[model samples]
Target: MAHCQFRLVNGPPQRYIADGVAWVLDPAVGGGGALRNLGIHGVDAALSLATGKLGLKSVSIANRIHPGPVEDHALLVLEDEAGALFIVEAGYTFASMRPGGDFEWRIVSANATLIDHGDHVICATLDDAAIVDLPVELPATRYRLFMRDTLDRLARKAPPPVSIEDYVAAMSLIDAAYQKAGP
Candidate 1:
């Protein structure tokens, strides 16, 4: 992909402790907020789609909606070695506690542009204005599918789909963004 944009937003967790601390908002408890919790997936996807290694370009973090020690929203811009750009946005600032909140993944290339708006996908040609709506049949419980795949791989003595190195690399990118947006 020449360019990719990803976003995930949701309202803050409804449940709070007796002390009025939402676990996700507690630094000690959650380790980090939206960026670490939700945005890492975007980072991983961006990295996978990138033509080459990605480097952080810019970062912005905020806790305006739910002021606390942790940020409720984050935006990250990354550039790949091949000059591709990736933008990632994650937040816990949506107004509702809906299950999936709002999610979108848009990718642009020389030939076409693909946009996935959680429920459906749209593809548009770059040369022409031709657009097509793609159906999405996502499982209600994806964890079951994940587990099945993982177990099957283990039975065959194969490595997991997502390796430890991938996790570390993603986390390192997130850490870099946090460091760049230092207190």
Candidate 2:
């Protein structure tokens, strides 16, 4: 029901890791690179929404990096138990920021299809196929939303948005990806 693409910004100070970054996107410093780090979230959302369960019927991952360890580009083709497909493309090799980078997620169900196509979020119907673009501004700062949600949840004595089980499920998928990313 859902698929998304994430584009990693490759700039001077933000791109590389010499002393620091906002948060290290490197495998050596941050434990996981783009595939295992960024790709997991999209995968989790897709699978969670499609099946309401973390278990995937099948998962195939491919690494498209250079002659090195880090995976700068990766694709995950996943199928849920209900026979829904979730294609996740995560990469750091996005060419430029001109006209905005390609970063979005979409979910298509029997009745309606919801899409966040970087510039706007739209809802399409299956019956009439009418598209209704929503007037919603995507957050500029990524951490701000996470922090606010976490604080609010803590104050309300509610569980975190992402739980330990979610982490486990995501890691399992990553592990499967590594195992299948053959030598």
Against the correct fold, how does model 2 do in TM-score?
0.77
Show pairs that collide, candidate 1.
Answer: none
Question: Residue 88: error of model 2 in Å?
Answer: 1.2
Q: Write the per-residue lDDT of candidate 2 for residues 47-129, one digit (tens) a residue.
A: 46666554433443434433244666667767666667777666555665333345677777788877776568899897996
lDDT of each: 0.85, 0.62
Error of 1 at 22 (Å): 5.2
Among these predicted structures, which one has the highest lDDT? 1
| Local error of candidate 2 at residue 68 (angstroms) | 4.2
Model 2 ranges with Cα > 4 A deviation = 1-19, 22-29, 52-68, 97-100
